[model samples]
Target: MAVKSLTPYPFAPKDTVDKFPAPLLYIGWEDHKLFCSPVCVPMPPTTTFGDLVRGTLPGIYSAHPDFARIDWAQTEWFLSGQPFTPDMDKTLAEHGIGHKSAIRFRTPGLTGLNGSCF
Candidate 1:
Protein backbone atom coordinates (compact mmCIF):
# COMPACT_ATOMS: atom_id res chain seq x y z
CA MET A 1 0.00 0.00 0.00
CA ALA A 2 1.34 3.39 -0.93
CA VAL A 3 0.29 6.63 0.69
CA LYS A 4 -0.32 9.56 -1.61
CA SER A 5 0.32 13.05 -0.36
CA LEU A 6 -1.25 16.17 -1.73
CA THR A 7 1.95 18.12 -1.02
CA PRO A 8 5.23 16.29 -1.42
CA TYR A 9 7.99 17.28 1.01
CA PRO A 10 11.24 15.55 1.90
CA PHE A 11 11.42 14.33 5.46
CA ALA A 12 13.42 11.79 7.42
CA PRO A 13 11.61 8.73 8.70
CA LYS A 14 11.08 8.61 12.45
CA ASP A 15 11.88 4.92 12.78
CA THR A 16 15.40 5.24 11.48
CA VAL A 17 18.23 3.79 13.55
CA ASP A 18 19.44 7.21 14.63
CA LYS A 19 16.15 7.80 16.45
CA PHE A 20 16.63 4.86 18.81
CA PRO A 21 19.11 4.28 21.61
CA ALA A 22 19.96 0.99 19.93
CA PRO A 23 19.09 -0.83 16.76
CA LEU A 24 15.77 -2.64 16.64
CA LEU A 25 15.95 -6.40 16.19
CA TYR A 26 12.91 -8.48 15.44
CA ILE A 27 12.91 -12.08 16.66
CA GLY A 28 10.43 -14.88 16.31
CA TRP A 29 10.00 -18.50 17.29
CA GLU A 30 8.72 -20.44 14.31
CA ASP A 31 5.69 -22.72 14.75
CA HIS A 32 4.90 -21.09 18.10
CA LYS A 33 1.45 -19.68 17.93
CA LEU A 34 1.56 -18.45 21.51
CA PHE A 35 3.16 -15.28 20.22
CA CYS A 36 1.06 -14.22 17.28
CA SER A 37 3.83 -11.99 15.99
CA PRO A 38 7.52 -11.43 16.25
CA VAL A 39 8.98 -9.45 19.11
CA CYS A 40 10.84 -6.23 18.46
CA VAL A 41 13.66 -5.55 20.84
CA PRO A 42 16.23 -2.78 21.08
CA MET A 43 19.66 -4.31 21.04
CA PRO A 44 23.21 -3.17 20.56
CA PRO A 45 24.74 -4.16 17.28
CA THR A 46 27.79 -5.34 19.20
CA THR A 47 25.84 -7.90 21.20
CA THR A 48 27.02 -11.40 20.51
CA PHE A 49 24.73 -14.01 19.01
CA GLY A 50 25.43 -16.23 22.03
CA ASP A 51 24.21 -13.58 24.42
CA LEU A 52 21.14 -12.99 22.29
CA VAL A 53 20.25 -16.67 22.49
CA ARG A 54 21.28 -17.47 26.04
CA GLY A 55 20.84 -14.20 27.90
CA THR A 56 18.16 -12.42 25.94
CA LEU A 57 15.86 -14.99 24.38
CA PRO A 58 15.39 -16.90 27.62
CA GLY A 59 13.98 -13.81 29.24
CA ILE A 60 11.47 -13.44 26.42
CA TYR A 61 10.50 -16.98 25.42
CA SER A 62 11.07 -18.85 28.66
CA ALA A 63 7.38 -18.75 29.47
CA HIS A 64 6.73 -21.16 26.62
CA PRO A 65 6.80 -24.74 27.87
CA ASP A 66 9.03 -25.91 25.06
CA PHE A 67 11.65 -23.22 25.43
CA ALA A 68 13.74 -25.07 27.95
CA ARG A 69 13.87 -28.18 25.81
CA ILE A 70 15.30 -26.49 22.75
CA ASP A 71 18.51 -28.02 21.48
CA TRP A 72 20.78 -25.13 20.60
CA ALA A 73 22.86 -27.37 18.41
CA GLN A 74 19.89 -28.45 16.36
CA THR A 75 18.03 -25.20 16.23
CA GLU A 76 17.54 -23.82 12.73
CA TRP A 77 18.14 -20.11 12.28
CA PHE A 78 16.98 -17.72 9.60
CA LEU A 79 17.86 -14.12 8.90
CA SER A 80 15.53 -12.07 6.76
CA GLY A 81 13.84 -15.36 5.70
CA GLN A 82 17.06 -17.05 4.62
CA PRO A 83 18.73 -19.97 6.38
CA PHE A 84 22.02 -19.03 8.03
CA THR A 85 24.21 -20.41 10.77
CA PRO A 86 25.47 -17.82 13.24
CA ASP A 87 28.74 -17.85 15.03
CA MET A 88 27.79 -17.66 18.69
CA ASP A 89 30.75 -15.54 19.63
CA LYS A 90 30.33 -13.06 16.82
CA THR A 91 28.48 -9.82 17.27
CA LEU A 92 25.21 -9.15 15.51
CA ALA A 93 26.93 -6.56 13.35
CA GLU A 94 29.46 -9.17 12.30
CA HIS A 95 26.63 -11.25 10.93
CA GLY A 96 25.45 -8.28 8.87
CA ILE A 97 22.36 -7.75 11.00
CA GLY A 98 21.43 -4.14 10.69
CA HIS A 99 18.67 -2.15 12.27
CA LYS A 100 15.23 -3.76 11.90
CA SER A 101 16.67 -7.10 10.85
CA ALA A 102 14.49 -10.12 11.53
CA ILE A 103 15.89 -13.24 13.10
CA ARG A 104 13.81 -16.38 13.39
CA PHE A 105 14.58 -19.77 14.88
CA ARG A 106 12.88 -23.12 14.67
CA THR A 107 13.17 -25.80 17.28
CA PRO A 108 13.36 -29.13 15.49
CA GLY A 109 11.25 -31.23 17.85
CA LEU A 110 9.20 -28.51 19.46
CA THR A 111 6.27 -27.21 17.52
CA GLY A 112 4.06 -25.67 20.16
CA LEU A 113 2.20 -26.54 23.33
CA ASN A 114 1.46 -30.27 23.15
CA GLY A 115 2.10 -30.03 19.40
CA SER A 116 -1.04 -27.94 19.10
CA CYS A 117 1.06 -25.10 17.65
CA PHE A 118 -0.35 -22.77 20.15
Candidate 2:
Protein backbone atom coordinates (compact mmCIF):
# COMPACT_ATOMS: atom_id res chain seq x y z
CA MET A 1 0.00 0.00 0.00
CA ALA A 2 1.15 3.55 -0.67
CA VAL A 3 2.20 5.68 2.28
CA LYS A 4 -0.68 8.03 3.09
CA SER A 5 -2.35 9.69 6.03
CA LEU A 6 -5.96 10.02 7.14
CA THR A 7 -5.87 13.60 8.39
CA PRO A 8 -6.82 16.44 6.11
CA TYR A 9 -4.81 19.63 6.07
CA PRO A 10 -6.25 22.69 7.73
CA PHE A 11 -8.82 24.51 5.68
CA ALA A 12 -7.48 27.13 3.34
CA PRO A 13 -8.96 30.41 2.30
CA LYS A 14 -10.55 30.30 -1.14
CA ASP A 15 -8.66 33.33 -2.36
CA THR A 16 -5.29 31.76 -1.73
CA VAL A 17 -3.76 28.87 -3.59
CA ASP A 18 -2.50 26.03 -1.43
CA LYS A 19 1.22 25.52 -1.75
CA PHE A 20 1.50 22.15 -0.08
CA PRO A 21 1.58 18.92 -2.00
CA ALA A 22 -1.80 17.42 -2.73
CA PRO A 23 -2.98 14.41 -0.72
CA LEU A 24 -1.95 11.08 -2.17
CA LEU A 25 -4.41 8.23 -2.00
CA TYR A 26 -3.55 4.60 -2.46
CA ILE A 27 -6.38 2.89 -4.30
CA GLY A 28 -7.05 -0.81 -4.52
CA TRP A 29 -9.65 -1.94 -7.03
CA GLU A 30 -10.57 -5.35 -8.33
CA ASP A 31 -13.00 -6.69 -10.89
CA HIS A 32 -12.11 -10.35 -11.44
CA LYS A 33 -8.63 -10.86 -9.97
CA LEU A 34 -6.91 -8.40 -7.64
CA PHE A 35 -5.20 -5.54 -9.42
CA CYS A 36 -1.49 -6.00 -10.07
CA SER A 37 -0.13 -2.71 -8.68
CA PRO A 38 -1.20 -0.19 -6.12
CA VAL A 39 -2.85 2.92 -7.63
CA CYS A 40 -1.82 6.26 -6.20
CA VAL A 41 -3.95 9.33 -6.91
CA PRO A 42 -3.26 12.84 -5.74
CA MET A 43 -6.19 15.11 -4.98
CA PRO A 44 -6.92 18.28 -3.11
CA PRO A 45 -8.83 18.10 0.14
CA THR A 46 -11.52 20.38 -1.27
CA THR A 47 -12.51 17.65 -3.71
CA THR A 48 -15.73 15.80 -3.05
CA PHE A 49 -15.84 12.00 -3.04
CA GLY A 50 -18.18 11.99 -6.04
CA ASP A 51 -16.02 14.38 -7.98
CA LEU A 52 -12.93 12.44 -7.11
CA VAL A 53 -14.33 9.19 -8.43
CA ARG A 54 -15.54 10.77 -11.64
CA GLY A 55 -12.36 12.74 -12.22
CA THR A 56 -10.04 9.89 -11.43
CA LEU A 57 -11.62 7.27 -13.66
CA PRO A 58 -9.82 8.25 -16.84
CA GLY A 59 -6.40 8.01 -15.31
CA ILE A 60 -7.29 4.80 -13.52
CA TYR A 61 -8.55 3.21 -16.70
CA SER A 62 -5.21 3.82 -18.34
CA ALA A 63 -3.55 1.81 -15.61
CA HIS A 64 -6.12 -0.93 -15.07
CA PRO A 65 -7.97 -2.13 -18.10
CA ASP A 66 -10.64 -4.03 -16.15
CA PHE A 67 -11.76 -0.71 -14.73
CA ALA A 68 -13.04 0.26 -18.16
CA ARG A 69 -15.87 -2.29 -18.29
CA ILE A 70 -17.51 -1.85 -14.90
CA ASP A 71 -20.63 0.19 -14.18
CA TRP A 72 -19.41 3.01 -11.97
CA ALA A 73 -22.85 3.66 -10.52
CA GLN A 74 -22.70 0.31 -8.76
CA THR A 75 -19.13 0.74 -7.56
CA GLU A 76 -18.20 1.01 -3.91
CA TRP A 77 -15.30 2.66 -2.13
CA PHE A 78 -13.57 1.96 1.16
CA LEU A 79 -11.09 3.63 3.41
CA SER A 80 -8.95 2.02 6.09
CA GLY A 81 -10.74 -1.22 5.23
CA GLN A 82 -14.11 0.23 6.23
CA PRO A 83 -16.94 0.99 3.85
CA PHE A 84 -16.89 4.65 2.85
CA THR A 85 -20.34 6.11 2.40
CA PRO A 86 -21.30 6.63 -1.21
CA ASP A 87 -22.44 10.14 -0.40
CA MET A 88 -21.05 12.11 -3.30
CA ASP A 89 -21.70 15.45 -1.69
CA LYS A 90 -19.05 15.46 1.00
CA THR A 91 -15.62 16.90 0.43
CA LEU A 92 -12.48 15.22 1.76
CA ALA A 93 -11.89 18.12 4.11
CA GLU A 94 -15.46 18.07 5.33
CA HIS A 95 -14.90 14.49 6.45
CA GLY A 96 -11.38 15.17 7.73
CA ILE A 97 -9.62 12.90 5.24
CA GLY A 98 -6.03 14.03 5.15
CA HIS A 99 -2.92 13.21 3.22
CA LYS A 100 -1.83 9.73 2.29
CA SER A 101 -5.23 8.13 2.74
CA ALA A 102 -5.89 4.72 1.22
CA ILE A 103 -9.05 3.99 -0.75
CA ARG A 104 -10.40 0.76 -2.20
CA PHE A 105 -12.95 0.18 -4.93
CA ARG A 106 -15.10 -2.83 -5.73
CA THR A 107 -18.01 -3.63 -8.02
CA PRO A 108 -20.93 -5.07 -6.09
CA GLY A 109 -21.68 -8.74 -6.83
CA LEU A 110 -19.32 -8.89 -9.78
CA THR A 111 -16.04 -10.74 -10.19
CA GLY A 112 -13.95 -9.95 -13.24
CA LEU A 113 -16.51 -10.57 -15.99
CA ASN A 114 -17.88 -13.86 -14.77
CA GLY A 115 -20.78 -12.72 -12.59
CA SER A 116 -24.09 -13.31 -14.34
CA CYS A 117 -25.58 -10.20 -12.79
CA PHE A 118 -23.96 -8.11 -15.51
Candidate 3:
Protein backbone atom coordinates (compact mmCIF):
# COMPACT_ATOMS: atom_id res chain seq x y z
CA MET A 1 0.00 0.00 0.00
CA ALA A 2 1.10 3.57 -0.65
CA VAL A 3 0.22 6.51 1.53
CA LYS A 4 -0.39 9.81 -0.27
CA SER A 5 -0.80 13.43 0.67
CA LEU A 6 -1.97 16.42 -1.41
CA THR A 7 -1.21 19.68 0.25
CA PRO A 8 -1.40 23.15 -1.28
CA TYR A 9 1.45 25.52 -1.14
CA PRO A 10 -0.37 28.72 -0.23
CA PHE A 11 -2.20 30.07 -3.21
CA ALA A 12 -0.35 33.19 -4.22
CA PRO A 13 -2.08 36.52 -4.28
CA LYS A 14 -3.24 37.32 -7.79
CA ASP A 15 -1.20 40.48 -7.90
CA THR A 16 1.88 39.00 -6.31
CA VAL A 17 3.69 36.12 -7.99
CA ASP A 18 5.66 34.94 -4.98
CA LYS A 19 2.92 34.83 -2.41
CA PHE A 20 2.60 31.12 -1.62
CA PRO A 21 0.52 29.73 1.19
CA ALA A 22 1.39 26.71 3.25
CA PRO A 23 -0.16 23.66 1.68
CA LEU A 24 -3.20 22.08 3.21
CA LEU A 25 -2.39 18.40 3.36
CA TYR A 26 -4.80 15.78 2.05
CA ILE A 27 -3.97 12.15 2.61
CA GLY A 28 -4.95 8.94 0.83
CA TRP A 29 -4.05 5.29 0.54
CA GLU A 30 -3.37 3.10 -2.51
CA ASP A 31 -2.82 -0.64 -2.48
CA HIS A 32 -2.26 -3.57 -4.81
CA LYS A 33 -6.00 -4.20 -5.00
CA LEU A 34 -7.65 -1.03 -3.75
CA PHE A 35 -7.30 2.62 -2.91
CA CYS A 36 -8.83 4.01 0.26
CA SER A 37 -8.62 6.29 3.27
CA PRO A 38 -8.79 9.68 1.60
CA VAL A 39 -8.10 12.05 4.45
CA CYS A 40 -6.68 15.56 4.46
CA VAL A 41 -5.01 18.14 6.65
CA PRO A 42 -6.95 21.39 7.12
CA MET A 43 -9.87 19.88 5.23
CA PRO A 44 -9.41 19.66 1.47
CA PRO A 45 -11.38 22.07 -0.64
CA THR A 46 -14.06 20.67 -2.90
CA THR A 47 -12.44 19.55 -6.18
CA THR A 48 -9.90 22.12 -7.24
CA PHE A 49 -7.41 21.03 -9.95
CA GLY A 50 -4.33 22.33 -8.17
CA ASP A 51 -5.49 20.61 -4.99
CA LEU A 52 -6.02 17.40 -6.94
CA VAL A 53 -2.43 17.30 -8.18
CA ARG A 54 -0.42 18.57 -5.24
CA GLY A 55 -2.10 17.09 -2.21
CA THR A 56 -4.96 14.76 -3.04
CA LEU A 57 -3.01 12.62 -5.51
CA PRO A 58 0.02 10.37 -5.54
CA GLY A 59 2.84 11.46 -7.82
CA ILE A 60 3.71 8.07 -9.28
CA TYR A 61 0.09 7.62 -10.28
CA SER A 62 1.06 8.53 -13.83
CA ALA A 63 2.86 5.19 -14.12
CA HIS A 64 -0.45 3.42 -14.34
CA PRO A 65 -2.06 3.25 -17.77
CA ASP A 66 -5.63 3.37 -16.53
CA PHE A 67 -6.21 7.12 -16.10
CA ALA A 68 -4.72 8.78 -19.17
CA ARG A 69 -7.86 10.57 -20.30
CA ILE A 70 -8.54 12.22 -17.00
CA ASP A 71 -7.42 15.76 -17.59
CA TRP A 72 -6.23 18.27 -15.05
CA ALA A 73 -6.08 21.19 -17.48
CA GLN A 74 -8.99 22.93 -15.79
CA THR A 75 -7.87 21.70 -12.39
CA GLU A 76 -4.96 20.09 -10.55
CA TRP A 77 -6.55 16.94 -9.22
CA PHE A 78 -4.19 14.07 -9.75
CA LEU A 79 -4.88 10.39 -9.08
CA SER A 80 -2.96 7.46 -7.68
CA GLY A 81 -4.62 4.18 -8.59
CA GLN A 82 -6.92 2.30 -10.94
CA PRO A 83 -10.38 1.62 -9.66
CA PHE A 84 -12.10 -1.75 -9.78
CA THR A 85 -15.75 -2.80 -10.18
CA PRO A 86 -16.84 -2.31 -6.59
CA ASP A 87 -14.93 0.95 -6.44
CA MET A 88 -16.54 2.46 -9.50
CA ASP A 89 -19.60 3.91 -7.82
CA LYS A 90 -17.72 5.29 -4.88
CA THR A 91 -14.98 6.74 -7.01
CA LEU A 92 -17.36 8.43 -9.37
CA ALA A 93 -19.50 9.71 -6.58
CA GLU A 94 -16.60 11.10 -4.66
CA HIS A 95 -15.03 12.89 -7.63
CA GLY A 96 -18.39 14.00 -9.06
CA ILE A 97 -17.66 12.28 -12.36
CA GLY A 98 -21.10 11.11 -13.37
CA HIS A 99 -21.19 10.76 -17.13
CA LYS A 100 -17.56 9.74 -17.38
CA SER A 101 -15.98 6.39 -16.70
CA ALA A 102 -12.42 5.55 -15.71
CA ILE A 103 -10.40 4.03 -18.52
CA ARG A 104 -6.84 2.91 -19.23
CA PHE A 105 -4.41 5.81 -18.74
CA ARG A 106 -0.67 6.39 -18.70
CA THR A 107 1.37 7.77 -15.86
CA PRO A 108 3.63 10.62 -16.91
CA GLY A 109 7.29 9.81 -17.46
CA LEU A 110 8.49 12.77 -15.42
CA THR A 111 11.41 11.93 -13.20
CA GLY A 112 10.39 11.79 -9.53
CA LEU A 113 6.72 11.61 -10.48
CA ASN A 114 5.86 9.49 -7.47
CA GLY A 115 8.73 11.05 -5.58
CA SER A 116 6.18 12.22 -3.09
CA CYS A 117 4.36 8.90 -2.78
CA PHE A 118 3.87 8.83 0.92
The candidate that wins on TM-score is: 1
For model 3, the superposed segments whose C-alpha errors exceed 4 Å read 1-23, 27-33, 39-60, 72-118
For each candidate in the order shown, give its overall lDDT on alpha carbons.
0.94, 0.67, 0.35
Relative to the unseen true structure, what is the C-alpha lDDT of residue 115 in candidate 1, on a scale of 0 to 100?
Answer: 94
Candidate 2, 14-108: lDDT as tens digits = 42224446876677765544456557766788889778777875666545445666677788777867876656889987766766677777877
Residue pairs with backbone overlap in model 2: 4-100, 5-99, 5-100, 7-98, 8-98, 31-112, 32-112
Q: Rank the candidates by lDDT, best first.
A: 1, 2, 3
Candidate 1 vs candidate 2: the lDDT winner is 1
TM-score, predicted candidate 3 vs. hidden true structure: 0.22
Candidate 3's residue-wise lDDT over 1-118, tens digit each? 2235587555534522133242233343322123333443332224453444444454534444433434433222234344422222233336543221222222233212243332
TM-score of each: 0.90, 0.64, 0.22
Identify the superior model by TM-score, candidate 2 or candidate 3. Answer: 2
Q: After superposition, how far is residue 71 of candidate 1 from its true place, in Å?
A: 0.3
* Pairs in clash, predicted candidate 1: none
Which order, best to worst by TM-score?
A: 1, 2, 3
- The candidate 2 region of ten consecutive residues with least summed lDDT is 11-20
What C-alpha lDDT, on a 0 to 100 scale, does residue 70 get in candidate 3? 44
| Candidate 1 C-alpha error for residue 85, in Å | 0.2
